[model samples]
Target chain A: MADISAHTPTSEIRSAYLEMTHRKRLYSGLMLAVFVALMVSGFVLADDRNAGGFWSGLHRLFDFPAEVLSEASEKLTDLPAHFVHFLPSLIETVNIAAASTLFGAMIAIVLSLLSTRGLARWPRLIPVFRRIMDITRAMPEIVVALVLIFVLGGGPVPAMIAIAFHTAGALGKLFSEVNENASLKPVEGLQSVGAGWIQRMVLGIMPQVAPNYLSYALLRFEINIRASAILGFVGAGGIGYDLKNAMSWGKGQYDEAAAIFLLLFGTIVIVDQISSALRDRLTHGARLEATL
Target chain B: MTTVTTDVITDLKGRADTLFLRKRLLGFALPAAVLVYLAYIFFAFDIPGLADRANLDNGKTLIRDSYSYKTHVTLDNRSGDITYAIEGERKGTYPDGMRPDWVSDRDGMTVVDLGRGNSVQFAQGFARIVQQDGLTVTARPDRDGVNADLPAGPLPDMISASKNRLMVTLPDARVTVTRNRVEVFKYAFGWELFFFTLDSPYHGMGFPTLLSKAVSGEAGAIWDDFWGNAMWRHADVAWALFETILMAFLGTFGAAMVALPLAFLAARNFTPLMPLRFAARRLFDFFRGVDALIWTIVLARAFGPGPLTGALAILITDTGSFGKMFSEALENVDGKQIEGIQSTGAKPVQRYRFGVIPQVTPVFLSQVLYFLESNTRSATIIGAITGGGIGLLLTQAIITQKDWEEVSYYIVLIILMVMVMDWLSGLLRRKLIKG
Candidate 1:
């Protein structure tokens, strides 16, 4: 905290200021150097462990995509048929996302209510329920899916349950955040009427927070679509499974692979666009309602 | 004028009524649609056939294996040799002369105490089982398959009888007899060999005893035994856990570093050229649309398989997301702040450094931190595909079809890892952003 310029003449202030700035610059430079070293060493270590070298693999990066694209163009006439062939699988993937989101949202509502302060049925057990949500949310979808596939056999059900489990945990946290901003007046009014817990939640909290919940759910749905596709690649059943098969076939099946890639990409973009649009409207409408 | 006023009031009333009517209709229609969709899914997913295909026994095995380990007491009929093992694995085999308290070797006869007065006596010629209910079951190997003599009444459901084998299922224990061997499995709670395998000297020592030994300068020995546990593979699991976190760290930070500069190019305020900005935005879209799953696949081809490939996949996919988010943040940067800095005759670079970065750092940093937490979960899935990290180990264990205990262990560790990262990121965000 000492200032060397304070005890010196007025002329020394500029020199002291410059000295301080130089020291600050030196500290920042050192920090930057350390960061650079970490990144470089980490990259090297990763490259060493990797099966393929980084530099050699860089040029070949576009090879697979190019092959698939060229082959699809060559068989352009079969593109429509391939699209038809994969449509059902695409539907299945979407269904998985939709059902999981529906089920997960249902569970998340209760969990959020339980975990949120001032809204908890049993305040003492709020931490328990919150931790439960945390653990469930922390579990990656593939862990449960793979484990369920072992017991349930390979099917969409495993994927559905796994995704729903994770979705519940994730949506639960977001729902609770929304719940925190909700007015307690409605809840108190319902309580004065001697309504039951479920009744109070449905008639009081549900109406107040419906818009935010809907928006968050829409976002989750968009995410779940991508997750479902990825799960399919791991053999949970969907277009992802077919894509994997076609991919493994290497050269001959590039057309089918391209079709799948297109389907997945198109579905994702469309869903994202639709959901974002819906979310925008929902929030805008809510703001309008507030103004009115 | 009076008629006009009346007409307007009536029109407003009609509109309100119609709105409520539509709302009511939608309430019913939405539920109806959801029900119809669910019905479609039920058949589409073949839920009806799921019941037939579901292996309830596998569920039972998984649930049981997660909590309880069965110690196998085997009597080799051919060699007249007796051995005891946990989960029937050699890694859990007892030492040369050491055995569990429940099992006693009396001369040539092996007697397994199945608890609560249920004991199985294995001998050279025959095996005898004492049931908790006082039913004495005896099986003798003969030419006409093993002959079993039971109480003269009808056989109970707990006992399975066949020409080749006789089996008795107990709540705490089980006894099975075949032509070749008689085996008894006693069920116990908790994971066995979690700290020290059977070969270790510290296998059955209580926690208090271990602590005392540690205080007596045996700490290294204890640590070595626990760390090198063959059945659990603590060392490998730890390494896999580190690799998973490393993947997330390298990916999230690396993407942030790459995206920050690129974001300036995409930001409309920073880049006046329409075509260049459009191209940059399109590139972001391409990467985002391709997504982490496809990116992982493509990268794994060039990178082969490791944490590096998974990290790069995350880096590429997240670069797109960060670029889009960061460009928007940059575009929204306060023009007044930059103008103020410029009024001091500061260069463009210095103006951005002083005015723009400080404004956007908190928002961008928060976004990056959030991604850091999420990418940890993503890394697990990516690692499974790329053949690295705990995810790979989990799949391998699950595929082997029996190591449900190890699967459960890995799952617990993964959940713990995510929770820790979640806590750590939250802490870092509060500290760095607020400070």
Candidate 2:
């Protein structure tokens, strides 16, 4: 019996290997067929002659100019023009973002309070409010701009609205989550002393989550500045408009664009540095309080 | 007993007085009223128009009728002048004998003599016939170019009637119809009219015109025209999306990359030096304080407008995020494995590679993958500011008063691209983590 078992040893391993190989081949073949079908359909249905010609022409036109500019700019300046232009737009973009973020944070606080189960009379409404938050967050800022462009007639208002709405959604969700996960000891103690919801929130929950809120708000501000730069593309005037103009012209003015971009980068770096420092202070303060 | 109870009550009242103050008559009520008023204003302010059934219907009609006109169109080319017998029986007809002189052939389309001075301009899939007087001469909108316009209202029945009858207008501004815009009742002919003439053959006016010129082998000229003149003409409205993407990517990735080393320092389990850990933690907070877009504009100004500027902006913004996230993950790592590696007389580098890395690699990869997917869309936004890619295309389409068809096309393409990136990133993340 021992000899027979030894003879059949490792048969299961071999069979499993064989089965895996067979499955792999099947899946590959299926995927290949689908890919081929797609290629064939695209070729057959597309206006290939027109599309191909147009693409080739566009490549030639844009590429040739870009090449010439790259060479000329190399000779004329020590640095690329794109570098120079990017600097200022970057700064303005930061300013817009910072303002929007602070505004968004203020709004988010009120909205979060309304959405929170702990504060609401009808706690069941929390889910409904959460769903609304989800919908707002789900939309990209671009889509928001598109919709608001129509209503607001293509101005900073649309961009501002888009940023505010998205920030509110993001911050509200974060605030609610933080509140839910917070330690209940302090809250309970306040409640036991007959403290109202507002008082408890101000004294207990806010203190615990304030640092986190500030950090998140700062992060959002950075994001909003970038978003504001693009808002110009939809006629919400910003640095993006000038950049588009430069590229479209295919002139060597990439220096201007570069300058603007550099400005944006530097501004962001400085702001980020400052924000991180502040965040460190807050967190450290929180840690000290916790230890005490 | 009564005196004792009174004293106790007095003491309780005195304690309450210290905690709460009685307000003047309307102090609290005034604030409440103001709050209510603000809420009312917010709710009452005009909300944007919803995409309701009626609005969509109106948009559809607008698109359909804008293309539904009959006119005798004459094309002027370098080879010669070619005349087309355009028959428009409906409210959307191209007028006969209309010549648009301002339309140059070099510009891809031109108008020629249709037996009179009246001109018709044909480009892309649609044709515009303007009377010498410079008013829309084909089909007058019933409500003075408001209500009865094809885009604003329903398709008029006049189109069906002029199927066979070639109504010709003299260059002298004389208009004539063969049979009063009556419907032809023959199946074969009717079918041809419905399928071939009324329906759009090319995708839209701008695309087809551009494509047609390109296919004609003037590819370079077409591209130059598109990029130089067309794109810049709407620059203010087309670069925003590009800027947005650039900012997001730079913010997310920049933060992640910078945070990598700091994360190591901040990890109590991994960091042998207590001071380094504390410093890294402090640094992480400073970086994360500001938002990403703010960084973008700042960088844009510092670097100038381009993808690099956008990237730098994103980098700074993301540094804080990645630092915090990475530090937390580091703290949560299993201490036993770290201790075991340490016991083997492994150096800090070896311990990190064999112990900490193995544990945190999955989380790090997942975060990176998520950021990449998010950044792809963000890249488009940066491109809007930096003047590159599809965002620029979208902005141009909107500003030129071009048909929404082009706008829809760009949008759908962007969405599909984003979906593909999302799917690809998700797959890579799962495979890398093997989870």
Candidate 3:
């Protein structure tokens, strides 16, 4: 209204806005169409390659679950015994996660510190460390685990190494992000006191970032637990190995599979709950209520 | 009053000392605990035993095979017919009367140039290795054994002679003679038959020649040969990569679409019914708690192994995650915009459309894009289980034990794929979120 003049009409502005709106709608429609086309074609291609049709398989989805449930119900008394038998394997899985997280987090702390701009010991080598992290992160755990399993034979060691390898890369990126937000005054103060690089970092940055690092490492632990289990299924040896054995036996052995599933499910839920609670404490302190 | 202040200062000092003491103790205790746990794991995981169980030779073979390939030149002692094959594979065998440029055949005599002034000559029943440093090793195969002649004070570590076999291992070539066959293996760097196999007309064509042929309208044929290369199977690998990406794309977007509406139910701000909200939340938890590994197994049972199973597994698992995150996002949306829209006589749906969505769009899109990149990796792992994508190919290549070259190729491709996806997602996230 302030810019309006005697020669310029309101109709011209309205028409211009309308044309822009029309063009936006057209582009949106085209984008939506392309998205739909891609989804539909992808679905069709996947369906074609699948052993069973999606439509046909949809109804039978519950059948396997029902069978497993029924068998477990029938063999309900054996559940406690099965749990006892598989408990050590469960502990092994948890240990794999915990150890890998510890190792990975330690490596990540060094890597993140080295890669961060202001805190870097050698500014020139930042890109090199960053590239190392990127390459490590880009590698899937299964790839390394399988290759290691070939050389080292199947065991928890391979799985542990695989998960730790990936966790370092992942946690390194997150920790560097955390490092960026930290004030450099403490580091400078420590440096002015003639403290060495390690001492400066240990005395300065760690206190500021310890909580966030713990929170992220805890989260990675949860993820690594799942990863270690999956690696076990591929012959790396854990509870998942037992589960695979139980599953491969088929039908009559469904009770064992059920027990393994319950143990895994329960462990995951418990770990998830505990870690989230711990993370909440670390991040929010006393401000956030006990939601769990 | 001074005494009271001094007492307070002493109390504060006491607390500070206690806090510092606790921190010092924790600093030591945490690493100590970690070390103890690691030591326990070392024993429990049998790390010491690993040395005994581990096969170092396999590692050597894997490392060696990844970068270099060997061409087998075998002579049948009885018939005196020589055969040249790359990696000793039928698919890489030279055609009858055709061999490498380094191998020459004239007057029933064949000499293979092993490079670095080393050569292997086969004439009649005997094979001789000629070294530039004035060392000649010859072996003649007979029914019982190989008769070996060596200019040796003591046989070097590179040469191992037995009753029925005489073997010489050098940096460039290896000659092994048994009772019935004499074989020379010439090692060369790089993946052999990567582009075109022995059957293809363009197998050994130079880049300039290939370019000229392409300019002369032979591009499609050349591409077809490369694509359909039996040794490498480039087309299958490309398709597998596409399938892996497709699984990620379809799973991520599919989960987002399915979760958005469900998220409204789960969100405390959107749904007034507590029971319904609880139900939705529990449903999401159950979906997520089952884990993608279990979901993949369950879906594979129903759908059978393919990209569909992998995609559905990712979809179901991610739906849970997206639902929780989306609902949390929905709960945190600013109510002022919705109130403004409501004051304009807008219905609930219209209010959500104009007011709520714009605020949440950036967060939701960023989350979805992040998941898209991660799901690409998950798709790879799930593909291994379900037998669909690059993971399946990688696992297959690995399991073959001897196809380390192919395994390395697939690994490089996978890493590149993941990095590209990561870059693409980051680019899209920045572009879409900001613009």
lDDT for each residue of candidate 1 in A184-260, tens digit (9 for 90 to 100): 99999999989988888888898889999999999999889889988998889998888899899998789999999
lDDT of 3 by residue, A206-226 (tens): 988888899999999999999
**CA lDDT of every candidate:** 0.91, 0.55, 0.92
How far in Å is the alpha carbon of B209 misplaced in model 3?
1.8
Model 1, which residues run further than 4 Å from truth? A1-24, B106-108, B142-144
Fraction of the reference Cα-Cα interface contacts (below 8 Å) that each candidate reproduces: 0.73, 0.02, 0.74
Error of 3 at B166 (Å): 2.4
Interface RMSD of each: 1.0, 11.5, 0.7
lDDT for position A130 in model 2: 73
lDDT of 2 by residue, B180-211 (tens): 22111100111112212222232124666766
Compute the interface RMSD for candidate 2. Answer: 11.5
TM-score of 2: 0.48
Using lDDT, give the best candidate's number.
Answer: 3
Residue-wise lDDT of candidate 1 within B165-207, one digit each (tens)? 9999998888988888888889999998899998988988999
Over the full model, what C-alpha lDDT does candidate 2 score relative to the true structure?
Answer: 0.55
In model 2, which regions exceed 4 Å deviation?
Answer: A1-92, A146-155, A183-204, A242-255, B1-339, B342-353, B380-397, B400-435
RMSD of 3: 2.4
**Top candidate when judged by TM-score against the true structure:** 3
Clashing pairs in 1: none
Residue B173 of model 2, lDDT score: 28
